[model samples]
Target: MCRWMAWLGQPVLIEELLFNTQHGIVDQSLHSRMGAEPTNGDGFGLGWYGSGEGPGLYHSVAPAWGDANLRELAGHIESPLFMAHVRAAIGSAVQPTNCHPFRHENWLFVHNGYIGGLHAVRRDLMLAIEPGLFADVQGSTDTEVVFHVALTFGLREDPIGALERTVGLIEAVAEQHGIPDAVQGTFGVSDGSTLWAVRYATQGPARTLFASSDADAIKRLHPDNPRFARLSAEDRLIVSEPFSDLPGLWHEIPQSSAVTVRHGGVLEHQAFTPRVPVSAAHA
Candidate 1:
């Protein structure tokens, strides 16, 4: 598995989330307390929206903790919405193209779990991607295939629905191949304004996911903490794990749920289950 973090709120230094906290994303890259693997050294990537561009991406087939370029960039660039991912490479090659925070136009996506039986269903999944989007697939990872499948099902128009359809398709193919527990993932996607995050697993157990408490509430609760006080209510962060040691500042996103954060900082959570039909064999 991998570890990732997504930020949406007032523009702040990228390092604030990547390196400054007690167990920031950078720290997690080297010593994740909750991930199945302690060290996610395969590769890393960062994606952020720019002033007038779709999104800017910085990816390297280098460990996040030791990459000098990433350190330099994190120190220099700042965006109100951005995503960073450190890879552990479940069954994929350790290549730049396979790095997370994969981008398409304005959308950015990252996943923190593997597709069960990926190799077995790779051919069917690949053939299912729309031709135009299929040509854009540049990596041999199940994560990339999931992204393309979402695009094929109309991610731009309906992100949640698209993703549900993609998961359904993947599950269907897995069942046909007699593969059990076909999907296992905690995923996050954003389009610079709205963010959609899901914690789910076909086997009913998924990786950890968390979202920061409301900035205003935290500020009120811990008036002396300058860090929390500095943030506006509009600021929000969602990560694979808590970035800091603040006891009440983080809340675990329940398993089998989805969280959506809007531009104005309103957050909503709901039960999330693949709406597509599943076969008994697949389950």
Candidate 2:
């Protein structure tokens, strides 16, 4: 349904990752090999960490492959952390507000999934959001709602737990509505520092998720490839698909799992289990 990529580690011009790679986001926008649709041209967004308290955002209701503004800004911006996405609208309209990398304070979130029967349960889920956060709902996509739900459940203090609750709430609500296939997708979240991702689905196999192998691992895999050699050990990429065909350079995150990229490629992996937060049941 969408394509996204995240970068953490050495500071580099955004274009290097967004435009320069052989099968980068731009390429994915036009010819994604793994998304539900090959083309994710509905809209696009960028969220990057620079010299600011929170990440920067740029969204457009244009196809990512042809967005000149994105190319221009990417050519100039250098960030230590970056989250970029090219969307393929599911049940929502193709609009800027519905773009990925939805932000809340210092956090940014992107997802490639849907809440089954969202139109039916949207009202119930909206009631579940904390009042303070409820006002921030500006888009009608299930993705935006998921981001806010995570925030309502404590994204700042506990991302994994918050997402667990977020998914749990979605599943519970889906059950209430008799929608057996509750959720399916991978979620990426960042707080201007570490990058985290969850690969999950309620009733089937989760969507694809890949993280760059350790710098050393990549070097060993492609011993003489300078492109792999130049990157710092800290530089890591988490993407929907590997940007290139280099074998062993990308590790597929397992189903029902969570990964954290931090401290220079010291990837942390954990089994993800979702349970409804107390509020989900009542709301």
Candidate 3:
């Protein structure tokens, strides 16, 4: 498992969440509260959208807490949308390509869980990826494979559906190999605009996922705080755990559901169930 976060709202320096917050991603890299392990230091990555058409990405095999480059870069880059991830290798190599917030065109993805019993099902799942997308698979981590699998099934057009399909296919393959409860993860995905936080598992409670309350909700909870007063309705932070322990600041995402935050404060929290897509159930 790993720890990660995604931000979508007004432009702000990356360090605001990466380091400056009470228990931000940088701290989580060293002391994650909800991840399977306390330290996710094998590798780290950051992806953000700026003036570029596709988003910029930075990755390293260094522990995030020890990466001075991450410190300096976070202070300089400001983005309206960004994702950061710190990895903890379960059964994969600790390398650059295995680091997350993986990018493909304008999209970036991060995940906090792994394919249960992957070694048994990896081959079959990899073969299911469409040939065109199969070539873009750059890392051996299950997170990267999940991203490519979603792309293979139209992630660009229907993110939620594509993700569900990915899970469905993984479950199908896992079952064929006599593996049960084969997937667990909270995926953070974005296309340089809308951000989606999806939490689900094949047959058990998924990993912990949380999202910052919208401006109005925060204001209602903390009316006297100037910081809460100044927030725009669109400001949102989705993370594996709360950045701060402040009550009412973070809302736990319901299991087997997703929260989609679009431009202009459009928040859609909907139920998510992974079903074998009729089109791929037999494939």
Model 1: CA > 4 A from native: 277-283
Clashing residue pairs, backbone N/CA/C < 3 A, model 1: none
Give the per-residue lDDT digits (tens) of candidate 3, residues 1-283: 7899998898999998899788998899899888889999999999999997899999999999999999999999999999999999998999999998899899998998889889898887788788887888888899888998889888999999899888988898888889897889899889988998899988778999998888888899889977677789779888999998878899899999999999877779998878786767764
Best by lDDT: 2
**Per-residue lDDT tens digits of candidate 1, residues 1-283?**
8999999998988988898889999999999999989999999999998697798999999899999999899988988999999999877789989998889989999999989898899998887778888888898888999998888878889887777778888888888899988888798999888899988888867999999888878987899987877898788889998987767888999988899988767789987767553321244
Shift in Å, residue 219, candidate 1: 0.9
Q: What are the per-residue Cα lDDT tens digits for candidate 2 across 16-125?
A: 99989999999999999988899999999999999988999999999998999999999999999999999999879888899989999889999997788998889988
Better of 1 and 2 by TM-score: 2
Better of 1 and 3 by lDDT: 3
lDDT of each: 0.87, 0.91, 0.89
Q: What lDDT score is found at residue 43 in candidate 2?
A: 95
Per-model clash counts, in order, read: 0, 0, 0
